[model samples]
Target: MSEAAVPDGRAAPTLTARQPKAVHSALTVLEAVARLGAGASAQDISRELGLPRATTYRLLNLLVQDEYLVRTPDLAGFALGAKVVQLATVAAPPARLASAARGVVAETRAALRGGVHVVFFAGGRLTVVDADPDFPLSDAVRLVREPERFAIGRLLLIDRGAADAAAVRDFAEFGATRQLGELAPAYGCVAVPILDGAGGFAGARGFSGSRPRADDPSDVLTVLRPAAARLGPLVV
Candidate 1:
């Protein structure tokens, strides 16, 4: 919270600050649920985004009412609602590419020790096209909230030339490795870039996993690289 000066010299809360922040948190809650993929419970959203349980439920119910989210038949989880899909379709570049790579993405996710995700940049924001429903590593909320903190997000940032000097140097040295406790503290992640048919930067594919020991840095290249190679030529 920031403070502003009043005539009485006492600190006053900035006007309308809390409202926008709440709005941001509500949106982040949605992203976290999306990343959690299939069978995500309300508790899962709360934990991932560090939001209060009451707040999480409020946001979830609101989105559900607005049709931005849909509850599962068994009432065990949540998925993107029809209205959300309708909105995404408006400029959803990754839709086709995301669909085509599903098989490979699943295969890659299975081959690895954790959940995998396919991300693309659209409308100046990152979107998670797909995630391993059975084993989501990190919540999507983190990816959307502070993208520069993760491997895939950093890759996208660097590509757009939006990264700062320190970030670039750090990426060069560390590559795309977001160790557990660093970002989610409960999971680790690694990413590889995907090129479009023209061989330019198109998107990113990566996986989240259990935090590895110091000797390892959540390396997924052996599996992710091949997946990207198999997927790159097809996205066009």
Candidate 2:
């Protein structure tokens, strides 16, 4: 609220160079946390960015408060927050599906009793290529922001060899991952991996239905597996 008088008697706002420095420091801190993964301590970030210990802590707290960063489960360090994922989703467009791929999705939707969705893995991130309009995902934003919450996201995570025992177990039993009443109170989902021509993980095919069907997905997997195979080359 303070101002200094200009040479011509006009008033000029007083601004400190430190303000811009603070902005730079905050961005640097966020970059450090992302590079360090989910459990990057303040000390680690400080050293990585060559910033003062006090400044690193201050920026970390501010980022967390603004939802740009979040403390790890053990509260030991930090990780990229939901806001980052939301921004990334908005900035990056999903890969366009060819006509053949679209037909595969249409056929699957017609054969399936519930929602049929497709997602692809690109740049180490999951992109929802085709979402079922008739039965939309419970929360598409949350599905991408928090991958561990949906079976489709879990399928991608399992492919990455992440340390998720539950996702691994679901894949082993059903040849897909299952999410029962997790995304929503009454709905459930199952997702199977779609592999590329070379057998590399390309994407996932997801189906959402009632809780009972999700809990016992044997019948659903029968239909999903072949569809996923049919879709693999088309999408890739």
Candidate 3:
């Protein structure tokens, strides 16, 4: 075999690549905190991330200061913070629904100046996977943990004549139907079902604006349906 000429007429030297400090440090800290989940102590983080104890403390302190992680009341352990919750609510993958629906949520928020929420059915409950700034109405609708009083979750179930059914059933119907809407005295919302590549329902994406503004469900549906349509195929 003929020997190949090296680039610039010189043989390439075997050398180890240098890791970028910022990127490496950030990733190391992130992995450490994630492995710790809701029970990570500073020492635990140091061991998990394989960094010096002082370095780990510095990184953890920075993360806590920035709201990426929160210390427990006793200050012995740490858990993910609200900012992380907010980010995860809008950026979770594997499920991939949040990422797929983010654009639609942004657009809806811009148009209505109200909250946009993406809800998912999990473990017999509806979880607010994502919520825009307009959410948790200040003077109007009071936020509740359960779905019964929430406009988005209730409408997703009841509007389809499946109010009494299981959450999974309602979600299934929602995915198959592609669109749903309802009017409430306090607030109103429009929802569209997202489906994956295999044509299975993934989740519900919707916009919650002022009740008076969303007076007509069809009007909101017009805006919401198209956005969901754009996202549905990309959920997988």
Candidate 4:
């Protein structure tokens, strides 16, 4: 009998299946702690995940012991640990931010046929969170370590005098007015501040494209301001 025609019985290869429930439970706990921002109590976790108090406590203790979570000195609550941040720094994917900004970024890319980048400020530097692939400008978009030298960061700081209170004030005013400008000769980007629910500057959203095809800085502002406004709630 041919191998294809034979009805011989053979054992199927065993494949290990992932425990999604456990993974989801851990993720739920982590997200709860992150949303609480800094310190979250066991009761808070239980309420957030709708889990039994004992189970919440047990998981919290395990996470804390494993260094994925940290217990406050008073032991009243828990927060994410340095190890967790480190792990996130290395292994965490950019799916959430990418997903959230996909529509806006796609629209900008379609309009400009250049790159659109969403950046977050941290440790006195801008970090590129996501970008479009068809951006016609240089490939500097992939350098995620620090964005201090990038046009997006510079333009975001255009009002801050690069790093001064006056500049910050200028930036705030410009953000309110929705100004646009060019960062380099061949590259121009439009930036608008992402504001939090309480109206604080969360970060900046920017769109970049080829100098030749790039719209006037003012036009860029008009295109990006609305999108940035919509992104504020997702920042925190």
Best by TM-score: 2
* Candidate 1 ranges beyond 4 A from true positions: 1-94, 97-100, 164-180, 213-215
Write candidate 3's Cα lDDT for 26-58 as tens digits: 667766665555456888888776778888888
The sequence of per-residue lDDT tens digits that candidate 1 reaches over residues 15-128 is 475789777887897778678863578899989988889988999999878867767545777766645544554455546444667778878877885767777766667776
**Every candidate's lDDT:** 0.68, 0.80, 0.54, 0.57
Backbone clashes in model 1, listed as residue pairs: 181-185
**Sorted on lDDT, highest at the top, how do the candidates line up?**
2, 1, 4, 3
Ranking by TM-score: 2, 1, 4, 3
| Regions of candidate 4 where Cα sits further than 4 Å from its true position | 1-95, 98-100, 136-148, 155-184, 212-215
TM-score of candidate 1 on Cα atoms, chains taken together: 0.58
* Model 4 TM-score (2 dp): 0.45
Candidate 4 residue 56 C-alpha distance from true site, Å: 55
- List TM-score per model, in order: 0.58, 0.62, 0.43, 0.45
Model 3: runs farther than 4 Å from truth?
1-101, 137-145, 155-186, 197-200
Clashes of 3: 0
Number of clashing residue pairs in every model? 1, 0, 0, 4
Write candidate 2's Cα lDDT for 149-170 as tens digits: 8999998788778828988988
Q: Write the per-residue lDDT of candidate 4 for residues 1-236, one digit (tens) a residue.
A: 11233356754543335455666787789888877744468988899889999878877888877867776534677766645544444543332474666676677656654456676654444445654433422223212332333445554455344643533553465552221223346544546667767765556776665454333455666667777876767665
Report the Cα lDDT for residue 175, model 2.
Answer: 81
